[model samples]
Target: MLRLVTTSLCLYCQRAQVTPLLLTRPHSVIFQEENQLAVNALYDLSVDISKVRKLKGWVLRQSAVYVSETAALLRDMGASGPVIARVLELHPEAILCNPDQMEAQKKLWMSVCASQKDLVGIIEKFPASFFTSSSDHDNQKANIAFFQTLHLNKRIISKLMASAPHSFSRPVKQNEEMIQTLQKTYLDLGGKEDNMKIWLQKLLTQNPYVLLKLPNALHDNLAFLRNVGFTSDELLRLLSKLKGFVTELNPESMRLTLSYSEETLGCTDAELRQIVLQCPALLYYSVPILADRFKGLLAAGVSMEQIMETPTVLELTTQIVQYRIQKLRSFGYDVRSGSLEVLNGTKKDFEMSYGKLRLRQERPLFNPVAPLRTED
Candidate 1:
């Protein structure tokens, strides 16, 4: 009788333990089943499943097979299997988008795009741009209409939508305010009214995200530049030269870069202005990068005067400078004694210069037009 009692107690304990486990099992099984569905769907679509798993595992936990919906949409848009797979791989969040929302986005994009082919190309290149939240659809449409009223070319608007979707995703009022600020700044700096449209288009093309910045950023930077002694005309010229990137700069960063360049180049404020005018990179490049480039040049026997004369050399990396110097040395041309202009330019330019030097060396010193004989 005691044995029977002990057996009953053991059976009750086992049931108690299993009851809790059974309760939890259904939830986990459902999650695993959903994940498996996503995995299978992606595998069928020929996507890089490993990347999806690694970069966006959370996408698999949803109950729906979003990958299939997204893939079908891409296929209907004339995207090939490889392109569809690539788009999904690059932006797995695309799978999480609602099918109806994606369809609406397709029609909205088609309005801007010349054809399905162009739309497909844009989607292939910028998946995230196309797969933005459905909630922003209204704002995007309003912004597109607003840009149209501004007389921006449809192609430029399309480029903006693809490259800077966040700008279009915002309320039209925000973009309008930013545009007004830009226009006011331009006119205040003596920009011609006749050239305003072209200027705005060029600026937007150069940096569409510029509109995303607050109007205060443009105001603050201009104020700082004026305080630093740049006249209105100089500021206008600088604005034109920067291609609308001036708004991206803040006073503190600019102050540090200016101070560093002024001290490193041993130039007065006026001279530094000229240098910045010649190479706006002096403003764009960070101080550490400038310092490294300067150190590389000075160590290579290049004088500060040479660097000032060709400020573009600062664009070249230290490794490139060293390689070019080595190539010039091989040609018996010493950069230390020659102009830094020879070191500047693209790789093709350097190769052409090197070829000329090689030809000059191969030519006989006394003979002006004699061909050199080659041994058989």
Candidate 2:
């Protein structure tokens, strides 16, 4: 079982020995023991009943009046109940933490992203942002420098940090070792040093969790793609275009997705590779979504070859494909054979081409000078 410990409790446990009753009993069974003391630590906001329920652990020791001044600070700064609840869930000790520690966390959040609306995005992504320690602060600076070496700007780095604060929570050396290992592995795979930097930057900037991915995952993705007919040159382009390719992709699922697309589109594996090479994102789309678009296009009389030529149409929504195709067909135009322009042209552009925009009728504007006092 994963050893669950609150950030503050972990610090305390290190210095002092206390086994504290373990709530090892599955959470569902806990309600039967209603007589057992409930442990709710965070303070200030009224918590959700469900949240109150998740806070079920045996009383380690009676916590003193735990004031989450930091949580209060966020509420003061426009954080809502859900947001504060998430903060507590991610770091239960945030409520028990010293005022200064909470302040540092709030400050870090502002530094990374200040907009209250934006806070929901980052906080939801990295709730552990409020758990920074002195060493964590030092490591954060070093981590920034390390990412900067990959040519990421402060804004992107801030976004990355928001998304994966806990990933970079560990010491900087651990991350450094991982990056070095990845770089060496890429070189061993016959990747060019200059190109490897670009690919690595693309991957990490979009999905920093990929950095913490199982060490063999990168090699596996590369090998898997190559075996599935991605040529060496095409693989570089694939990595360049699909930033989350390595981090988010699953090998078995990708093979299934590829096979499903090939069968649905009535294309051979080579033809599938051609379209995927044109639009790398095709591989990322779920099989159902891919099928929906493919059948919609087939219904519109768009040949498989046309799809292969206009790979980007696969990226468009089913509604867009159907709407554009129907609109063009109504106007006696060939929706199937037309280039991307058929699918891409805006409504205004269509009106302009149909000679409607310039001729659009509107009520005549009256002279503002009281019609020059001419009643007639």
lDDT for every model?
0.82, 0.63
Per-residue C-alpha lDDT of model 1 across residues 192-301, encoded as one tens digit per residue:
99999999999999988888888998889889988988889999888888887888898998999999999999989999888888887678778899899999999999
Question: Pick by lDDT: which candidate is best?
Answer: 1
Residue lDDT tens for model 2, 1-376: 1122235432322323433434546553322232112233343354443553466332224232233454566677777877777765555544334455556656665654546657655665565564554457656767767777877665677777776776667777777776776677667656888888666776777767766766667677778999988877777667667765564677887888888888877888888898888888877788889889888888888888787778778888889878866765664667666665447446666556544422332336677876365666
Winner by TM-score: 1
Q: TM-scores of the models, in the given order?
A: 0.84, 0.61
**Inter-residue clash pairs, candidate 2:** none
lDDT of 2 at 103: 62
TM-score of 1: 0.84
User: In model 1, which regions exceed 4 Å deviation?
Assistant: 1-34, 345-376
Give the distance in Å from residue 171's predicted Cα in candidate 2 to where it truly belongs: 5.4
